[model samples]
Target: MLTVLPAINWLSVLVAFVLYFGLGAFWYLFLFPKPYRISLGRSANEPQSGNPLYIVGPAVCSLIITLTSAVLLYALNVTSYGAATLFAAVVGGGYLVTNTVNIAINPNIPRPFLYGLITGSYHFVGLLLISLLLVAMR
Candidate 1:
């Protein structure tokens, strides 16, 4: 329910979005494609369908996690910009490292580590940008 435009630092948000999107692009282009193809036994060049469930479901989840983390960080009196960045990095990186290991070790799990990677990366990038914004604003 937070009004992102007015309530949050727009510049920071933009930076986070860019960083997270870049990471996603990297993830898809480099880290995930081969593993995903291997796991699903699909051709490397198979066409992708624009499924609503696949897109919207994960997006909603990412939003929830990012917003929740931001709010919680704020509530905990860690609203400083540096704190936000560090929080995002710790939370995001932690989630990624944990999930990456889990998926890498156990490839049988459904959906692999795609969901966690996406969600965690978003949170990480968002928090990092917010933290930068906090510093700039200060």
Candidate 2:
């Protein structure tokens, strides 16, 4: 079967990608640092090492994820806000959040729900905002 690629709105995709990536920076670094550290069972006073990988790695992953989401939205021809939001919510909340919770639930991990809530909610909100931007820009 021959599959035709959709004409992408590059500007929309770029904006959505950046916004989603920025959301993560704000989410973990500043907004919920205390809860995030607590979720990992780390002491609030324990000095965090200035590790570049810890900062850069997740940023890179977020960028890739945002780009992938933008591409999918374009390919799916989601032009309306309602459709875009619905699609994003399904992909983000249903698939991504569900999987995150599941993985975090393994007995090896402590305070699994805390970690799951933090990451899962971020994905859902990030994807929702990305969808909104993509639709509005279109």
Candidate 3:
């Protein structure tokens, strides 16, 4: 499957990765800071500054996820803007949403459905942005 690497747009993948990374930043920082913290059973004001996992884990994971998504998009031959967005919606909704909801249903979850709603929505948005950037860059 990866033998198709030459056909893939590495530049588009990079752009999509960067865009998704930026969206994650704003999504966690400004959009759902308090609610997300509460969902994790943390006080919003609790210090996360010294935690490398808090900072680095997500960033690394985001890059890996974006890379995978880009590979999927390339394999799917997603070309046009409309097709890209549609593919993102279908894949993100079908797979990512289910995964997110499962996390929310975990036995250790603090608040039912709350984190799922936020996290799942963030993933959908990230997928959408990644799609847009990839198609536009093409």
Candidate with best lDDT: 3
- Tell me how candidate 3 scores on lDDT: 0.81
Clashing pairs in 2: none
- lDDT per residue (tens digit) for residues 76-119 in model 1: 54656667667767766776446554654455645545545554
Error of model 3, residue 84, in angstroms: 1.0
Winning candidate number (TM-score)? 3
Q: Write the per-residue lDDT of candidate 2 for residues 59-132, one digit (tens) a residue.
A: 78777776777777777878899998898889998887999899989876677899899989998998899888
Q: Which stretches of candidate 3 lie over 4 Å from their true place?
A: none
Clashes of 3: 0
Please give each candidate's TM-score.
0.54, 0.86, 0.89
> How many steric overlaps does candidate 1 have?
0
Q: Candidate 3 lDDT, tens digit per residue, 1-138?
A: 676578777888887777887888899889998888777777977654676787678778778877777777777877888898898889889888778989788768787488888889999989888887876776
Ranking by TM-score: 3, 2, 1
Report, for every candidate in turn, its global Cα lDDT versus the true structure: 0.54, 0.80, 0.81
lDDT of 1: 0.54
